[model samples]
Target: MSKTVTVSDQTGTEALAAQLAAVAKPGDVILMHGTLGMGKSAFCRAFIRAVANNPHEEVPSPTFTLVQIYELDRLPVWHFDLYRLSDPEEIHELDIEDAFADAVSLIEWPDRLEYLTPENRLDIHIEPGSNPDGRVFILEPSGDDWIKRIDQLSRDQA
Candidate 1:
């Protein structure tokens, strides 16, 4: 099963991110999909902040760095932006292996992962909503673990 959430503004998006963060754990993979300005990076920032339990936590987009690892007491969070990725094989250089095996991973431009993408993951596709400032998030869980975990989401607005 999947869940769809509609939010009227950026605050709503951030709230949803925080809610998801409350249920996330180590080794969970979140694949973000959307075009430019769809707030893919914004979602990741909010998620990382929530996981850190620090609303002021700095969560810079990994657009240039490719990967940003957030060290937390619960577990590390690897935020990856593969927009500049020239080759899927380059993911190794970003230590994606470690992210997949031991940490919570938030990947933007996940299509760039190519064959390196994990099978067990929660794919979040962002789309424009009815209003100009509104947004729609389609969350699809893959693999048994993800499917079960997704049910724990607090969102039922869909």
Candidate 2:
């Protein structure tokens, strides 16, 4: 199932992230897909700050490091940027399999994972909106759990 949310600026994007944070938990995997200059990094930064419970926390993009782990009060977060991955085999080296069981994972360029992606995951595709500084988030859930959460989000937004 899928849902779409449109935001007009950074604050709107962050607000959406914070709403997701309210329902996020350990073992959740969110795959982020978007072209460069899209708001993937900004969204991830906001999500990370929300999870960390520190609005001012400095959460850098994991573009070069591949994966950055953050220990939050409620659950650990595994942020992965697979854009620079040379091969899918490299994913095994990062031990992401372990993150899927206990941590909340936010992955960028998850298309690089190919078949390695979990069956129960959330796919978030972002794109530029019609207005300047606007963004559209296309959320597709791979499992019933996320579908229910999305429904709740819809009701809340309504």
Candidate 3:
């Protein structure tokens, strides 16, 4: 199942992330796609905040750093930014397989990675609308688990 959400601002994006965080579990992979300045990092920040139950926790974009690992209530959240990566081989050097094996991963610019295979992933596409604050978020499920989860999430929201 798939779902689409329209967010008007950063707060709405955060609220959506928080809602997802409540249902997200270990071993889940989230693939985010959007142009620059589309609030992908902002959504990630909110997701981590909700998962960690720490709204004040600083979740910065791992642009230059590549990946950032956060321990939230004993669950490891791995956030990856591949915007600066020019080669897919560079991702292999980062040993992302290990991170995927141990924690939940939120990957930005996943299109840059060639070695990774998404098993159970929630694919998010964010598009800018006519209004500056308006955004169109399209959620696509990549596996059976996500299909069910997304369906449930949508139904619950309804």
Question: What is the Cα-based lDDT of residue 14 in candidate 3?
Answer: 81
Against the true structure, what is each candidate's TM-score?
Answer: 0.95, 0.95, 0.91
Where is the poorest 10-residue window by lDDT in model 2?
149-158
Runs in model 1 deviating more than 4 A are 156-158
lDDT of 2 by residue, 13-79 (tens): 8988888888999999999999998988889889989988899988988989999999889788999
Ranking by TM-score: 2, 1, 3
User: What overall lDDT, based on C-alpha atoms, would model 1 receive against the true structure?
Assistant: 0.89
Clashes of 2: 0
What lDDT is reached at residue 116 by model 2? Answer: 92
* Candidate 3 backbone collisions, by pair: none
Give each model's whole-structure lDDT.
0.89, 0.88, 0.83
Candidate 1 pairs with clashing backbones: none
Q: Which candidate number maximizes lDDT?
A: 1
Best by TM-score: 2
